[model samples]
Structures are given as structure tokens and as C-alpha cells.
Target: MILTRAEELCRERGVQFTALRREVLEAVAASEPPPGAYDIAERLSRPGRRVAPVSVYRALDFLMELGLVHRIASRNAFVPCAHAHGIGENVVFLICRTCGGIDETTSPEVESGLGKTLKRAGFTPAHSILEVEGDCGACRDKARGAG
Candidate 1:
């Protein structure tokens, strides 16, 4: 379903979703904790085929442009967007500092408040990405157990 959505988006944008792009996107989606370009390239490499770092970076750029993937700046890694076609919506990522886990969510109230504030400040936002770094519930529970 994700791949199909990506294909549809590419068609709508008049961009070709080449095989390398698809593979790179798949590699990003398959990772639990978003991965960097080098990690993606390493994953794509196999017994007979080798995926170059440059190719992965190029594909990542294309996927990000299409809103099929998002780069977590703090982690320098890329993760697949949950709502790929809903690019207009604001996304917030909750990143677990201890376990490197990420939870993606959206809240209209948050977006509205931020939008209003930005508008008042004469700032026209291109994209809004909120990343909160903290310990996840499981990590907290594990800490409690160990203590």
C-alpha cells in the first residue's frame, strides 16, 4: 500500500518512481528506527548487487521531495511518513532518546496554534516539523525495573 501510494504520488507529480527509488524507499520503511543514507545503502547491498551511497542519497532526496519519507534532523536519519499523501498536515515526531524509537502523530490544535503564531510574526511557513526527544514508555518501565 505504501509503495502504491508513492507510485501514485510520483505519477501525479510527473516524476518517475524508478526502481532505485523504490528500493531505497523500501529500505527506509523497513528500518525500525530511521536509518542514515550509508545504512540504507549497506542494507541494499547483497551477494550479487551493490547499492552505492550516492545512489541512496539521490533516492532519499527524491522520496523526501515526494513526501514519502521524512528526515529526522536530530538523528540524521530518514523515516517513512505515515500519511504520505497528507503532506499538508503538520507532523510531530516523538523520538525515544534511550531506544531510538520514533512515534509519528498529528494534532490540528497544535498546528492551528503554531500557524496563528507564525502568521502574527509575519512568517509564512513552508513546512512544520516538531520533534520531541524523550524516553519512551517501555524505556521508562525498563528503568524502573532495573532500579
Candidate 2:
């Protein structure tokens, strides 16, 4: 379903979703805690063929431009975005420190408040990404049970 949506968006934007880009997205979506560009390049490389880091970075750029993926700046990793919310909306990545899990969500109230603040400061943000690090619900529950 995610791939299908990506394909549709590319078609709508009159851009080709090339094979390498598809492969890159597939690798990102398959991994947990996301994967860095070098990790993706290594995974895509085989015995006879080699995928360069630059090539992977280029593919990541394309994916990110189309809102098909996101960069977790602190981790230097890339994650596939399902485009669950409106385009250009703020993305909040709930990163679980204990389990290395990530859940993506969006908030209109947050966007509204930030937009007002940015407007007052005459600052425009290209993209807003909030990464909150902590233990997720499941991890907290597990700890409680163990205790």
C-alpha cells in the first residue's frame, strides 16, 4: 500500500519512480530504527555489484523531497514516511530509547501554535520535525510488570 501510494504520487507529480529509488525505499521500510545511507548502500550491494554511498544519498534526497521518506537527523538515519498527513505538515517522530522503536504522528494544534510563533518572528520553516526520545508505552508496561 505504501509503495502504491508512492507510485501514484510520482505519477501525479510527473516524475519517474526509478528502480534504484524503489529499492532504497524498500530497504528503509524493511529496517527497524531506520537505517543510515551507508547501511542502505551496504545492504543493497551484492557480491558482483556495488552501491555507492553517494548514489544512496541521491536516492534518499529524491525520496525525501517527495515526502516519501524522512531523515532522523540525530541518528543520521532515514525512515519511510507513509504520507499519513497533509503535505508540509509537521512530523513528530516518537522515538523510544529503550526499544529503538519509532512511531510517526502529526498534530494540528502544534502546527497552529508554531505557525503563529514563526509568523510573529518572521521566520518560515521549510519543514518541522520533532523527535521526542523516551520509553514507549509497551516498554513502560513491561517494566511495571517486571517490577
Candidate 3:
């Protein structure tokens, strides 16, 4: 699960991370594509078991603080961050429009490059998206074949 490290973190921080929290974390990590809160709530609510939307949302918020997950503002969805426990300023996600795939990569070079521009403008940057939308390799190949 993505929350393996998060669980360890909870232990270190003396926070009570519950089984429901782990379930919610795993639900996101297990999705072929990242799942929205509604989707996750539906999954958890199937048949005999259930978790409310508020419960799911609360768990998601807690997970976000722990850096176990990331919310995609463009899609209104969430996914497990690649570096669940890594020590970095912020992780950037490159989202693919065609295939709905997400690639998580760090950019020290980008940080330095953009940092220079921000400093020049006298504006200090705190957070950024760095999300680019484009066709992934598989989708590009498919498009080539179709054409």
C-alpha cells in the first residue's frame, strides 16, 4: 500500500491511523486510474460494507497531510503520490490527457530554473502544478496506427 510509509509516519507521530484509513489508501493505490472520492465511497459502500462520503473525505484529507496521496485539481480526483515518504519540497504530476495516465517525477532542475524567474519578478513561489497534458506513448502509437 502507499500508506506503508504513512503508517510508519503515524507511528512516529503518535497518531492513530486506523484500518479504514489503510483501506481508503489502498483503494486509491489499487485503481487502474486514480479514483475520485465518490468512486472510492462507492467501492467502500458495496454490498455489506460501507463508508460515508464524509468519512472517506476526512480520511483523504488526513492522507493528504501525511503525503500519502495527491489531489488532481484538473480532474477533481486523487492518486497515491509516487514518493510517499520522500523528503522533497513538493512532488509534481504530469498528467496525460489521452490515456488518463499520471507520471510522478521530481524536478530539481525545474525548481532552480523557475526559482530564478520568480526571484526576478520579486514574487516568491510556494506551490505549483507543473502538470502538462499530452498523449502518452501508447496513445500516440494507437493514433498513428489509426491514421
TM-score, each model? 0.88, 0.91, 0.88
**Cα lDDT of all candidates, in order?**
0.88, 0.88, 0.82
Report the backbone clash tally of model 3.
Answer: 0
Please give, for residues 16-96, the per-residue lDDT of candidate 1 as tens digits.
999999999998889977889999999999999999999999998888877888889888999998875466568889899
Stronger candidate by lDDT (1 vs 3): 1
User: Between candidates 1 and 2, which one is better according to TM-score?
Assistant: 2
The prediction achieving the highest lDDT against the true structure is 1
Query: Candidate 1: where is the Cα deviation over 4 Å?
Result: none
Question: Quick one: ranking by lDDT, best first?
Answer: 1, 2, 3
Predict model 2's lDDT versus the native. 0.88
Per-residue error for 68 in candidate 3, Å, reads 0.8
Off by over 4 Å in 2: none
lDDT of 3 by residue, 30-145 (tens): 88678899899988887787789899999999888877888888888898888744543656687878878887878788888888899999997767776766777888899999
Report how far off residue 80 is in candidate 2 (Å). Answer: 0.9
User: What tens digits encode model 2's per-residue C-alpha lDDT throughout 1-147?
Assistant: 668878988999999999999999999999886889999999999999999999999999998888889899878888889665556778888888888878788777888899899999999799777898998999999999999
Count of backbone clashes, every candidate in sequence: 0, 0, 0
Lowest lDDT 10-residue stretch of candidate 1: 81-90
